[model samples]
Target: MLFLDDSKAAHLFFNRLMESLPDHVYFKDREGRFLCVNRAHALYLGLRSPSEAVGRTDYDFFEPAQAKQKDADEREILRSGVGFIEKEERANSIKGVERWVMTTKLPLFGDDGEMIGTFGISRNISEMKQAREALNAHHRLLSTLIDILPCRIVVKDREGRIKLTNRTYRTALGLAEEDSVLGRKLSELSSDGRTQRYAEDDRAVLEQGASILNREDYDASPLGDKRWLLLSKVPLRDASGRVEGVVGMAADITAQKESEARAVEAQRALEEKNRQIESELQIARELQTELMASSMQSVQAELAAGSPFLPRLAFHYEPSAHLAGDFFQFVPVSQKSFALVMCDVMGHGVKAALVTTLVRGLVANIRVDDTSPAQTLHALNERLCALLDRPPLPRFVTAVHALFDTEAGVVRMASAGHPWPLLEREGEGAAPVSELECGPALGLIRGAVYRDIEFSVARGDRLLVFTDGWTEEADDDGEEFGIQRLAEALRRCRAENPYTTLDDLATALRGHAPGRTLADDVCAVLAAF
Candidate 1:
């Protein structure tokens, strides 16, 4: 071999280095025609050697658009006389897929210092380009999902500074674009007294590297509107599984809170009403028991007196509820004459009790000196009708009045649409004594007339005065304890002692239907002469 000069040897070494590079190297003339190509460029072009790629333009293998772009790049490099780098560009290859390449081109000059050609080096960067594109698409999808979510979402860095917030969070806080809430600490953005507490809680979550789910009441808006929010915060971790930051979400629950409060208030009101009703019922029951005891005591005391001609009296009183509208009284009109009254209002409970009390007061205060039974009833109806005409008028009541003169041995009775009185003799069957068809009920029609019927009372004759409550009481199966039943019950007990007979009658009526409650007030008075 002949010895070569240093310059020639260096030129040979540079050509070998270019061919060995893991890239395509080429030189193009000013008109963009290839002048020379390295071994790598020739291999990439599907040529066995550089001689096949030399002396060809890019138009020989590239599409028109690709050729034009390459020519423009070469012209730019030639005109600039400086190296130019392109991070990524597309290159057509003999294979099915296009290749992504990073290219650097420098201007080449002749010995005259005039630009001659462009020297280019290209490296394949397809994988890196695909990865960067995928990353960008993922970021765009994540941002869209956060913006459209219903709940407020926020992201904070490890330092407790806000990094990102969703659309819902910004809208709820009424923040403007000029307000840079990002990179700000929660305590700095929240001006309320509770902000410091929230910051402390966030610190705890970070230190513990755990999640926090809590229900909190906050007044965050400038208008100070209270709202309930369910907050959930989770720690975010880095690739090393170390806690990096926290992501939080808050959902508003103001409407649900208000509804629960209303429900609680309604329950309290219902409980209070029930308590009032129960208390009233208790008081009414006690009053009714006391009234019955007083009436019995008066009858017993009158019996103890030395009045041989006095009529023996007995009573049975029961109520459907704690209070009743049925009442009965015996007044000693004189030593020889006595008056008896029974009254029943239209309804029961507090309303009926009020009318029954009014009737009781009227009968106690009214003077009926030698007055006939019909006249006394007429007077009572007029008084009751007048009372009903005032504000808060009463409904109506059925009443019966009777007067007996032991000296004359005569009994007179009248009714205001009340059930007729029953009369029983020692050897005769019980019969209704007063007329069945009578005047309207008391307080129904003012100045209404009443009819009186009189009969002689023989020795050992019994007169029974009662309100319709006794006949109207219902059994478990809804059958009434009717007038016929009461008459039969009396006939069975007629021969018994008057006091014992009354007690037995009351017990029999209550026991008529076992396990069944009484459904009305009952009052029965028995007078024996």
Candidate 2:
């Protein structure tokens, strides 16, 4: 009905079909001039009507380069009698707008089968092209991101076929750039035992849909070099939450494993060394106890036998560690007098115990005629200063020396950076004897002079000498049991026996300490006059 037998009706139908199409339809003569054009083609050339572009060519409407390419292509189609089908090309319009179009060009034939001109149709494909280009760019960016990472990464399908891999993964398998690994199974790439094991693991993950995290394994490189690796594999799921693949990551942990092994060995050796030192310290502790007890007991016995007035000396020694830094020695200097020396070296343990040993040796060389407390400390300081002169940091000792003359009823005491003694008279309260002057700690300055303070003591009076540990014990609140508290505790003791009095004072100190345990070495001596 559209092409009823009349030539006018056929012409009208052809024009309507051409104008209704969204694509540009055009025809050109042998000379490359537009013979006819549809409405869409006319509008693309910036023409008001189809007739307006009848005598024009692409050169009048497009850039020189595009026009030239179009002319060359149409001429080739005309000569070869072959059509260019669905070829994508860039089109630049007169309005300076660029578009990508898929075009089909055909050589037109007349009724006599002779080539007359070229006819073409072009469809816009700019949006589709742009979308495809953006997708390719994203793929490149993702590939670069994974390739730059140091960890080996791999992605595989549920069938155990490799879908993606990073550069490190390829290099670890000694794969060259030209090698194609995608879509290949692990066994196909390498038939080694480890590769087979990896295939099994992939199957297990796919079946169970579980994640295997940080599994340490011993492995070998392509070159047979041993290595340690921490590997993790997790099931990659789809939008519907079904496991479809696996993402695997592996990190080289050989260095860390080796370091841990070395640390374990070092710890074992250190524990053994500690046990050996502990055994030696036990022996030294026994020897120290025997030597100190024998020296003190002999002096006490000698004084009791020689002097008309018998004096009582009682002491309590408690070492916080296996060995103590606190030491005391009693020397009988005359028929009616004795010298008592007490010392506390800086810290407790082997070093302090060694210093105490050296002090004991120096005390043994003291002459029996020298009863001056200050002179004895001066002599000890000079020897210690010479002996401990070389050190990164110097060691020090606090000391108190006293000469007790029972017949004269006097105690002459001198201190070298030690705590002041506490004095308690019969029927009077106890207090620190702070009036006694103090000198620098021993092992500091050579020839450091010490001065003695003479205090009278009658019958039924008592004097107490102690280390800082007794006054520096702290409770849970970090408050120290200071010298005042110590004096208060001493005043509360009403026992007549000197030993009982010392025990009561120690109990008070233990009660004030955290966990009822002392944190430092403590030494205390009570002299009952």
How close is every model to the real structure, measured as TM-score? Answer: 0.53, 0.83
| Residues 162-206, model 2: lDDT tens digits | 899998888887786624889987777776677767877788899
Which candidate's lDDT is highest? 2
- Candidate models: Cα lDDT each: 0.77, 0.84
lDDT for residue 452 in candidate 1, whole number 0-100 = 83
Q: Estimate, for each residue in 379-472, the C-alpha lDDT of model 1 and write its tens digit.
A: 8898888887665545788888887776777888888888898888777878888545977899879879888888888777888888776677
